[model samples]
Target: MNACIVLCLALTAFLANAVAQYETCVADTAIVTGGTPGVTVSIGRDEANEMVQITLVGPSDVWFGHGFDGLVMANNYGFIVDTSGVSERRFGTGYSVPTELATTSIVGTPETSIVGGDRTVVIERPYSATDA
Candidate 1:
């Protein structure tokens, strides 16, 4: 009976590790014409160490001049909890490039993929008066 308990524990640990082993990194792009230009984003598992990483390449010559305002949304993807059974539906945002490209990372614990299957990386450019 004791052996069976140990086996169960071992199995649990194995599954936990397996689930933790999945990681993903993806690079996406967003086009801006008027207001908040966004890009179609997709993130999938690659290796075990890096769950998800997203890169946004700005449109050519799409300069912010001063800076850029951007936000990343990971609404729903997969893996809500980790081995210890903790809420993992994490969401984050940040700034991107400066007169060039823009990028942000919605980093989370256990390295889970970004949520909201069809992730949208929105780049809210600083309103330019001269262009209009």
Candidate 2:
């Protein structure tokens, strides 16, 4: 009887962990840089279901925060970029919220910055079936 009870408890724990899994995945090559060393940074796609989360990571400088000011999230596709400080940084996936599937391709290019240590800016967007 004790062995059976233990087995049931183990099964329940496994099921609980499975249910708590996050639906997002980090992209393989999400970071992109621009001219100079710390002028522009971008992250491509961090997808989960039909939603993609992108983030811009950068160092602590005045110029860094200025680059990623007018960032936008698209239902189709978009980008966030940052480049303002001394430290070399990148943009990539952070976390994502759920979103509906996108019908058309949307494009955006917004920039922002972070001071102090390094920072990451995030945006979640949707995509079509083919593009995903």
Candidate 3:
């Protein structure tokens, strides 16, 4: 099992007062191995968009996604980063329903210099109300 490192910053009052001041919310990194080789997953939050950003560094053909809960089944919502440098917002009960989230500034350049290559994906969603 990969160890997920999560860093969360809660500033509801501060954010409400100073939306212009963006701060780091959550930052995490994990080493995942099972399917399609092993990949390093770095997750964080963009205070500006109040969304979670995910970066997957792995083989060129590897696909990566993450859900809210530990459950890997359907009915879960997550994002998929493909080798084609495309990010899809996926959700379903048994399978996956993929939709384009943000086409322009969502995906970052692939780091081909690395052993496998890395892709960054930004997820746009409101921050969780409750601090888990």
Candidate 4:
């Protein structure tokens, strides 16, 4: 009976993962040019929790963020790299606002790193019904 229970648990885990993989949607890759040449951004979403994942690859020591409603405006979340090569997540509102740290409805860890001469950042957050 113990062996059977273990097998069932393993199968259950496998099935759950399979279902999650099937519900994932990947957006088209976006190419960005300018200060950080060859920069590419890709976004993906999973139906389970409407979680969105953003991946960015660009030149090292560059900052990147996703702006909603406009460029560098409110509802923007991104990562900034200081001169010492340390990266930190930052949330801000647009200049038109009161110039304060904007609140975010996103839920997850946003991180950035420099690897192989490329800067990579991955951010994940669930979709808020009020976001739209």
Candidate 5:
């Protein structure tokens, strides 16, 4: 669906942000489509800390997710989000449910909130994977 593609575009943009800080990093935003109310995506780059902050706000009633690097699920990396929050990062090779990553990749703790029938999920990660 178009909405799903828009959400995925957010992730794809963030993926490009992995190497975006050639100079001062600026935050970017987009009003996502597809959802009844629509979703808002914000991506901020932390040049000093080499991190990227991504925020997604969407309807609380239905679960949503962001997929990166691939249009289809095959070998796609993504995560599911709900009112509760993100549980884990996942990778998939098919249309079925993706399995959690063997190792944690999040640079720091993620935060979430649900208010007024809207769910907001904020995730922060380094430009690269966290050190093992």
Candidate 6:
């Protein structure tokens, strides 16, 4: 098993305002059959800024992230945040640390905090970034 291996996601996109400081409403709900408890991944669109905000919450001892627009880790553009509130916009290429693309422009900073033994990382980036 690989990424999203232990944790499964049931993605749903809603084009409406979300509750509690979200720009747009979209989430990956947990399935009762076999889902990772106390884990969540939520995506919201910041229409005013033309960006997307990803909010992830999970165990405070490990790192977590979300990737999109590709098939495999190496093919995707993603943000990975460690437990200490450090994050990177990485273009994965292997099992080791990923490298950021030279032509890509990552916007804003990733924020992470641990409370109640849960780590929450929030990242914002351009909705459609240029590779050139």
Best by TM-score: 5
CA-lDDT, candidates in order: 0.32, 0.40, 0.47, 0.54, 0.66, 0.63
Worst 10 residues of 3 by lDDT: 1-10
Q: Report the lDDT of model 5 for residue 107.
A: 52
**Which window of ten consecutive residues has the lowest lDDT sum in model 4?**
81-90
Q: Which of candidates 1 and 3 reaches a greater TM-score?
A: 3
Q: Please give the TM-score that candidate 3 achieves against the real structure.
A: 0.45
lDDT string for model 6 (27-89, tens) is 854322243477677888867767777777877877766556665567566656665564455
- State each model's C-alpha RMSD to the native: 15.8, 12.1, 12.8, 5.5, 14.8, 14.8
TM-score of each: 0.22, 0.31, 0.45, 0.53, 0.63, 0.59
- After TM-score superposition, the amount by which residue 23's alpha carbon in candidate 3 deviates from its true location, in angstroms, is 6.4
User: Model 6, which residues run further than 4 Å from truth?
Assistant: 1-22, 28-38, 92-97, 101-106
Candidate 2 residue 48 Cα shift, in angstroms, is: 6.1
For model 5, residues 9-107, the per-residue Cα lDDT tens digits are: 999998997744533233333332342345666777777778777777777898876666565556756667875667555565557667767776675
User: How close to the true structure is residue 63 of candidate 4, measured as C-alpha lDDT?
Assistant: 50
Each model's number of backbone clashes?
9, 10, 2, 0, 0, 0
Of models 5 and 6, which has the larger TM-score?
A: 5
Please rank every candidate by lDDT, starting with the best: 5, 6, 4, 3, 2, 1
Error of 6 at 84 (Å): 4.0
The residue-by-residue lDDT of candidate 4 on 1-132, one tens digit each, is 999999999999999877533233544344333334456667777767677776667667555433344344455544443334323234444454322234554455557677798777665666652433
Candidate 4's C-alpha runs over 4 A off are 1-28, 31-36, 70-101, 129-132
